[model samples]
Target: MTSASRTFIDHAVSKVPAVTLGFWIIKVACTTLGETGGDWVTMSLNLGYLVGSLIFLAGFVVLVSAQIRARNFYPWLYWATIVATTTLGTTLADFFDRSLGVGYPGGVSIILLLLITSLGVWYRAEGTVSIESVASARVEWFYWTTILFSQTLGTALGDWVAGEDRGGLGLGYEMGAVIFGAALVVVGLLWLWPRVSRTALFWFAFVLTRPLGATLGDLLDKPVAQGGLEFSRLYASVLLLIFIVGCIAVLPQRAARRASAA
Candidate 1:
């Protein structure tokens, strides 16, 4: 290989954690925290969705910049970025769905389109959308942008599924959780099947986890009459944050190793 090729390869280091059971556990917790934390700011604190979005968006920008600038995978930083995206996603989705009068379905459609566009452009530019391919600043930007959209889309989806009279399935939060959870199991099964692209499966599962977390969050915070436990959003967020910290402390997370030169 040429000198330039060697340099490019040498700079490549997986900036994401290995896909493992613990990774999924922490991911679900982060998404759940996103929901409760967003709600705590927007509802419990009376900041409103627009204000909440602005706050979390600022955090998202800062953390994502730090994440891209880091030399290698840092579990805390990576997950902190994820939490920012999820919380921002919650508030941004609500802003579009309710504040903008687009409703949940419209918000879902719009956010999903954005997500597809991000992934499409990323693939066209990088030739792959796999997290394993996240080895550079440019790819990292694309990955986080795609994640923001997915998180927004997930919030809209979870709310729609839980809605009682707003053209929703009226499944309630618990049922919504069940459905998303079952879908994730199917995605896991597909991962074991031959010829299924791991990249595709990873993204699919990633998207599903967001809504699952959203619904579960709602289940924890919504009123009893609304089929929820009526827990305090702040308390729920703190509990989830603790779980995430514990998982990060105990879980094995390492950057993907560089490929050997031919």
Candidate 2:
């Protein structure tokens, strides 16, 4: 498709899936895989966060380029980019927490600030933070940056909650997941109620899902010694990956049919 035609049809194409149950299911799966797969590459192999991050960053660049080049939304390509973000987020968050010795709270605070800044800048630049406006390159850049920050923030928050007496907030991973999940329910109710910006509500839920998934992932894989079920990280991560692939395979992920005028 011609560049002009591609841009026009983009609007008609699905910018994002509906905020339904399936979306959250896939999202948490991706997030869990992000936690374990990232650890597999970085900690298991002893590659170090810097080297692991560089690898994932390169992958992110390639996947993002492919995503942007597509004439319409391709589920594989789009979701691949998301996986890239989560993996990258994993190593990046570790870099901050370990390398900088910022601890989980410090890392979470810094990443959260950056996320807020990216959103504020994007909204100021284009007057919207809605996914529906994620067509142009400028908005796309902002979108990806915000996503990276949110994922990283999720990692930090998960660590903070699940860690033992670190910041005096030791709810453990299961409890953390429950808390975040509860918060999500409240947010959903608020969104369904009066006076919430759909755009704002969407982003709020988007950010919360990351931590929810992160904590849940840790709860499954961390050792019983560490308040988890002692399940193998690889096993849990693989299961999540299979579920994600199955969902993508069965779901109707196609973009809308193009209009003749476009």
Candidate 3:
């Protein structure tokens, strides 16, 4: 085989999509959809948080199973699993924060612990938690578990910052979006310096996108009196889904280049 062909195959080995502008666009949109769609199921539909969590959890299990079983990167399936995780994260956060009376601050604290633990364990077992190292089923399991925790943490953290609690920034949705957006910009800039760890930056960007989505989603769907446009959750979710599909179709998507552990 030609060297060029070998290079292409090597890059195509990762099931996860390469970190790119298109990837971020879809990821942020998916998280936004998770917020609105979860609300649509739980609040607008009157199913409550527990039911919503169960529903999304089931979807996550099924889609993630399919994603793991697949031999190559399938953009649609990969994205579907992501949406399932974010949606599950949304409902689970609500259940813990509201139903269980843990509140946003408490929820954020707890989820962050889980996230840290997941990464620590993954790194210990695999020697690295980098996306490029995700080549085996065992590593992918670690990958998805860490993602699930991160998504949950993102939702709780986003709500904590945007909420009116005295312990948090209480910045509201618009300001919350601005804060995460600026943070993401800083991470992107840090990427330019080679000394900075790309794996670390990638995960930072990943976690940051969810809150950006949470704030943006809440800004669109919450009542006008609550500093939002009060759009119907179902309608907002549909629009976000359409945008995600359109981006996947229009933009380039390819798997990450497989490499050594960090």
Candidate 4:
């Protein structure tokens, strides 16, 4: 197909979901479940972070392959891939931070570098990093790679802020949640300013949601003395999964509109 025809085809059939309030809601739930579920597999099941990461990494690869192979947007499939990234993020962050003896600062710095590198390369290759340009499988690979890095960064940030016992700053989960939540509100305000970059804001919001969910998940599953409610990680994960599935079933699922291929 000609470039114009290819761009037109891409515009009509984006394989990702449109950004909406519902999208944010589901995203938060997915991230939270990722935290709890990852912890369950790593801690509760007695698997090391390395093992957990490898397992989730395998799942992520399989899911991404399926997502790319599909011809159209599939709500369940897309979200499943997202969850894979988040879970992989959780375990990978832990492995990097603890097992490798890199504290939060080191973990964040490493992951942030990776995230920036991914975005830089993607932009150089695709001309735009906006979700609007995520139409083809090549772009989808870039999108998911960027997402994995972002999720890992969020995992480190949240754990650093809340899980002080885990070599973090010990600010407590509530405070961590408050901090990330407030940042998100600020991003929302910027979104309303009319001069802010929508693509920048979207990524800000997307990365912020992961930490918010991380803190929330920690609060749900940590011991009361540690400032959490002491819930079972498995149970919390199950509950979050149910909520995510319900929202996906109830919410409007639409593909994102496309931008001209550069």
Candidate 2 per-residue lDDT, tens place, 1-262, comes to: 6988675646634544545666777887898889888887887788999999999999988887777666667777777788899889988988888877887788888899999999999999988777766766667788888988889888888888778653627878888899889988988899877788877877777778888888877777788887888777778778888988998888666553343332
RMSD of 3: 3.3
In model 4, pairs of residues that clash are none
How many backbone clashes does every candidate have?
Answer: 0, 0, 0, 0
Better of 3 and 4 by lDDT: 4
> How does model 1 score by TM-score?
0.95
Candidate whose lDDT is highest: 4
Report the Cα lDDT for candidate 3: 0.88
Candidate 4 per-residue lDDT, tens place, 1-262, comes to 6988786558535787889999999999999999999999999999999999999999999999999888888999999999999999999999989998988878888888999999999999989888877767788899999999999999999998886655688899999999999999999989889888898899889899999999999999999999999999999999999999999999999987755532
Spell out the clash pairs found in candidate 2.
Answer: none
Error of 3 at 53 (Å): 0.8
The RMSD of every model to the true structure, in order and in angstroms, is 1.8, 3.3, 3.3, 1.9
Instruction: Count clashing residue pairs in model 4.
Output: 0
TM-score of each: 0.95, 0.90, 0.93, 0.95
Q: Which lDDT tens digits does candidate 1 get at residues 1-262? A: 6877656544555567778998899999999999999999999999999999999999999999999888767899999999999999999998988888888788888899999999999999989897756767898899999999989888889998988755677989999999999999999999989899888998888899999999999999999999999999999998999999999999998765553322
Candidate number with the higher lDDT (1 or 3): 1
Ranking by lDDT: 4, 1, 3, 2
The segments of candidate 1 whose C-alpha lies over 4 angstroms from its true place after superposition are 1-12, 257-262
Cand. 2 TM to true fold? 0.90
